[model samples]
Target: MTSRGPIVGRGRSVSRRTFLASAGVTVAAAAGMRGGPLAHAADAVPPQLTVAVIGDGRTGVWASLRAGAGGRNLEQDLGTRIIWQPGFTASLPVMEAVKAGAVDFTFATATAVVNAVPARVPIVPLAAYPLPADEVDFLVQANSAIRTAADLKGKKIAHQNGTTGTYSLIKYLESAGLRLSDVQAVSLSGADAFTAFAQGSIDGWIHWQPATALALTKLGDKARLLSDVKTYDYAFYVARGEVAVNYPQVLAKFMKIIRETQAYIFAHPAESVALWASQGGFPPNGTEQAVYEKLVRDARLSESTAVALKPVDEAAAASTQDLADNFHALGVLPNKVDVRSFLLGAQFDAAKQAVALALGA
Candidate 1:
């Protein structure tokens, strides 16, 4: 279970029910027989642990990482069985589910974490990785009159509601000394926004990820990126505060495994692209590979000096506060809330130690 090594499971299966049922013995009998049938039966099955995931329309990379250890099953090489519960499609729902105790853990952007605070989601950042700002951008159709952020004034722009993309769009406007009211803002899902832009229904589009890649590549000469926003965004690994308290060891192991996968992605960018394309219903092409590479490179995982379950330092606290302040200033939130109060510092410390011991860090 070393981070630098491959995790290959033993492929062993045992039934706890059958073992317990067959080990018919009274407490006195078991006490007398230290290495008897009961003791042997207890070693047969590994413990199973479950966590929730919000698949981002593509790339179940988290699940894929677990499967790479052996097969695409719940069992892991760390002597734990991982049962993945995936369904919530976006960050907001993931936060809500965590708060409601529907799932133990999930992932989201730092922006989503900021928004979650006022929504009363009781979740905290366990770990974090940065994403290149270029993953999101303000785009205009080719041959359009819009050439810069300033040109967006009074133009119809499409962005998803309650997403980090909205924040990106607002930042783009702010850079141009414009506010949301300076232009006609249209709220639409990424899919719908793409269609609207393609059909000339909206003047421009604001979004991230494969959506941005799709628009730029699929549209070919028809889509022009007006600006890129890599410096202001983040990707976060988050979990319920309660889960961190109750299962700090589990969180530690989980973070270690994920860090291993993140390493794999950096090592094999082209192959990672193919895997994500297959999972997300895209063709394996050079365009797709390039997109995935930039997204992964922007993460700078290979360049990160952070350990698993990194504590929230002043810089981390400031990042969350910036998101909160930006959102509030833009009227996305009613008021700016102090995000550090929700951070689980002690829990992260325990998880970090657990990972170091379990993985021989």
Candidate 2:
């Protein structure tokens, strides 16, 4: 493996010699794409795997960094270069990428995977990352009269449409005995939701870290956390079915690298926060650090690869089915499809075990 230490920065310098060598090829041979073992190997190697990512602030940052950093580590471990794709903005776009065969892997909330699978694009969950429900804060201006969930009745709540935030908002409100019909739902992106909340256009907004922390800091005493989705474990790493099947070993190597990085992050929290902030282009105001700490504090990074596909996993599957049923009931999906088939099967389990072994779990 090439011995250059972790390359930092968005545009770090990398020589062709280093690239070829890291990819396990002779420099002269790789340069010529014909009539040689190097040429055949290069041709056989799949094009850089394109991983879709959501552009929703912190999760987006995490997805990009993890994939890039993890890919780099795997490149060194496997002596093969891995291509990292620029992430997309929303689950819809990511799903589109999967359908178009542009994205080979992705990390997103289970809710996103649920919705994508029915479209006939197989998405398999590899591992779970536990996110404390309180991490996602539902807020309103403190001076506003919306002091209780009851107060939100007939009021507008801003959230990203078709996201975990949207589901959590509905679930929380319903738990308070307020139905969707009782409150007005304002659909907006995370950034837009922040703006709407700031402009007094929306009574409440549901948001995840970094943005949640930023809103609290900016709105100060004016904004207060009204409700937190207390049991929400929102995200998971996933890969397209074709990629998972054809490159199981490669995928296993990828997951092993992620597990290692997660351990590194936990062991070196300060350094991890700094690296995340620097790579994510967060300003040096320490707000990013605060948010990173908050996420890391409540988050349980998976050390083992055979993640339990339990109630939450089932709920995620059910949620997707419910969404599809609702959409079909509302004339969305053209035909009824068995969404469960798209989930990870036995092969995935084998791959997980392989990764676990690699990680020394």
- In model 1, the worst 10-residue window by lDDT is 1-10
Clashes of each: 2, 1
RMSD of each candidate relative to the true structure = 10.7, 10.8
lDDT of 2 by residue, 232-287 (tens): 43456666654443354566666666656655555555556666666654654477
lDDT of 1 by residue, 155-195 (tens): 99998766777777777788889988888998888789999
The lDDT of each candidate is: 0.61, 0.56
Candidate 1: segments with Cα more than 4 A from true spot:
1-48, 56-60, 69-74, 277-281, 284-309, 344-361
TM-score of each: 0.75, 0.72
Q: Model 1 Cα displacement at 302 (Å)?
A: 14
Q: For this target, which candidate reaches the highest lDDT against the unseen true structure?
A: 1
Error of 2 at 303 (Å): 13
